[model samples]
Target chain A: MHLLAAELNPLGHVMDRNIIGGPDALLMGDPHGTPIVTMHMLTLLLATGLLLWIMNLAAKAITTGPSSEGNDRYLTRGRMAQLIEVITLYLRDTVVKPVLGEKTNKYLPYLLTLFFFVLMNNLLGLVPLLDLQHIVGAFLGDSHFAVIGGTATGNLAVTGGLALIAFLVIQVHGLRELGLAGWAHHLLGGAPWYLAPIMVPVELLGMFIKPAALAIRLFANMMAGHTLMATLALFGLMALSGMESWIAGLGISVIAGAFAVAITFLELFVAFLQAFIFMFLTAVFIGQLSPHDHEHEHAAETAHA
Target chain B: MHILAAEGNPVAVQLLPLVTTVVVFGIAFFILSKNVWPRITKGLDDRDNKIRDEIKAAEESREQARAAQAEYESSLKEARQEAAEMISKAKNDAKAAADDLRQRNEQELADLKQRAQRDIQTAKQQAVTELHSEATALAASIAGKILQREISVQDQQRLVEESLRELQPLK
Candidate 1:
């Protein structure tokens, strides 16, 4: 009949609900009138709190000596310092200041917060607990050895919401700067009168596409990295399962463990990279909404006149 | 079982993400738009400035303390040098005084010795002349006793002259 009746695979269990169809799929919300909450969403909120706590504590406990003392020392250096300083500087130099221009200092804080919120969310997704089995096992302790994991960004709906926010902000800023008529005209790609009809739909679609692309890129990367790691883990596990002797299983598991560890580190890099990519793209999109480079056009018009 | 399941129409597990996404997104938007993003940046900036100020103050204090210590050490070194020079000058002055006193004592001793030698020579000449005169006087008395006559002036002059020549050779 209509394709084979699907068998429920373990992948299906870890998969998030599909809202829209295919690559454009949005996250499925709750049927009981509750909104959908992805792992990434929870991760985002948690990361935001953690980031603020770390940053605030860092500021509060700041000391000038070669090393800080007591609680301040933990806040000021090592992992926390590495995390805070790297993300802050990245957002400031790459995202806020460049796109928003010299007048963007006021918005630097919001952008920085956003950058960290997204980055930490993405990074936390790579942590071991994101797996179903691991969480269950952690709760159960020695009761079970099973582990399950998933990437939050694998769901299109969550990324879609983020994109939508960026879209809304972009439009709001553009409208504020360009006014209503100017906003509409700007949407028309500022093409000649004869070209408006041809350009309008494309430009409008482009607006949605920009956000859609963001949602897809982040979702795909997070999903793919996790999927690859999971696949490799499964292969190692299968190899161990087939072994008759304990020694052989141990040998295979050791190798697999090493492989898993290597993949995990790579995924960690992917997490930060994806977040940076998202933030950078968002900045570029927002930058476009600012007043277009019309000074050159104005000068050209004046010369022609 | 199928009929009961259909009648219940319980939402399946696949739909869980959909429900979760909406609520989380709404909450995220509300929190982020309303409270989080607005104050978070300002809070961060204020904190950064505070840290910078603390660091600056600490550095300034350290610098001041270091300068004070250096100044104290330099003054101490200067004091030690001055003390050494004073000791050396006092020692040199004492040595010069002792040398001058020794030379003066030696000169006085030499002058006294020359004066003593001169006085002894004069005394010896006078003694010799007196003895010779006495001898001549005794001989004349004896002669007078023997021949009823005294010694002459020329004989007395010749005796005095002979005593003076012998005393000069002894001196």
Candidate 2:
């Protein structure tokens, strides 16, 4: 039981790398000793860098190319550009616009950035960069190269930061669309004035709860997938280290590898799905604050156009 | 190997990543909204309008062409109708002219026959008178030879009148 708990919980490895200022207690002889910059942070930078490069390419293609149909225009220039367009257009026309109604165009930039950022971060997490880095490090005497792999989205700080921005956007949009008085009054549901006290406090808590949910949902999903993968992998390692029978180890590894493969595919799907869910929720919340009349007029205009 | 490296708390809200994420997101939002979306939207809008207008114009021209074809067909039918009318009118006029010419030709032939008959009758009377005079003169001369005498002008005239009465049956 002790051995199983140690292997499954794996708290020791966590403690060793969790150090802020001290040298890495295990494995790596990184000249910096302590990793001031953690693995998750590097992965976050990688996702951001990729987003910037891809978006910049898409932006340039849009601005310079002549306006025409086919693969020449800004959105249609390349397969990747077209893919970006498909996602953005689907979210805007199908998901975002119909909800936000009048202020859709105003809030579009923030929404697109959120969707792509989250999606990129999620996708980056799916790559076995960390596993590969670890394997290579094991071969190369646990060098600094192994530090390159981590699921940035799996980290709480990263998701929390994303949720904070989403929360701000939702609140700011409400305030901007409806003035201070209107915004304050929104918390007091449509009940009688006497109910304002209870409803306001409840609604305020609801507001904070929404973003927190977003953060936890993303963090938990990523963490769960990573944990499951690690646990299954640990079984194969245990069979090799604990058992004298090499054949048992080989059989265990084969089973573990197959299950891991299946989970990896599931994780990939979750990455895309979660990003979409986060963006979708944000858009829906923003839509709730606006007036119905504006929505009706916007729908009419859209229908006519 | 640890799947996740715990850093001073893997779950802690680190300042470095949070700030970096925020800044990166901010820059992305600004560039995309300002630089990318506007141009793409404009191109899409312009292309949509242009295609629609061109389609409308093409449809209008096609309708006009159809109208022109109908008009030409109608005019062609009218011209054929007029030509048929003209050809029939000319045929009627030609038939009427042929009838008139036949009538005039018949009248001229009848007048020529009448003039020739009058000339024959005059020639016949003059010849008959000449023959009668000659005969009477010859008879008078013979008689004169036998009787040794010539016939007088009153007697010749009487003979000519007698010969004209005899030729009336033949006329």
Best candidate according to TM-score = 2
**Candidate 1, A1-305: lDDT as tens digits:** 11111111224323542233322123443344443443444554565566565655543333232244432542335566555655665677666776668647655544554555566656666666535554565577622222223455556655666677767777777788788888787766666868888878877887788777887888778767766666666655556657788788777777867887898898888877777777766666666666768554334323422
How many Å off is the CA of A114 in candidate 2?
1.1
Q: Write the per-residue lDDT of candidate 2 for residues A72-146, one digit (tens) a residue.
A: 442356778667766766887888877787788888778878888888988887777856765787688753344
List lDDT for all candidates, in order: 0.59, 0.72
Candidate number with greatest DockQ: 2
TM-score of 1: 0.54
> Model 1 off-target regions past 4 Å?
A1-14, A17-52, A58-82, A130-149, A243-255, A294-305, B1-171
lDDT of 2 by residue, B56-140 (tens): 9999999999999999999999999999999999999898899989999999999999999999998998887777667766766
**How much does candidate 2 score in TM-score?**
0.78
Worst 10 residues of 1 chain B by lDDT: B4-13
Q: After superposition, how far is residue A92 of candidate 2 from its true place, in Å?
A: 2.1
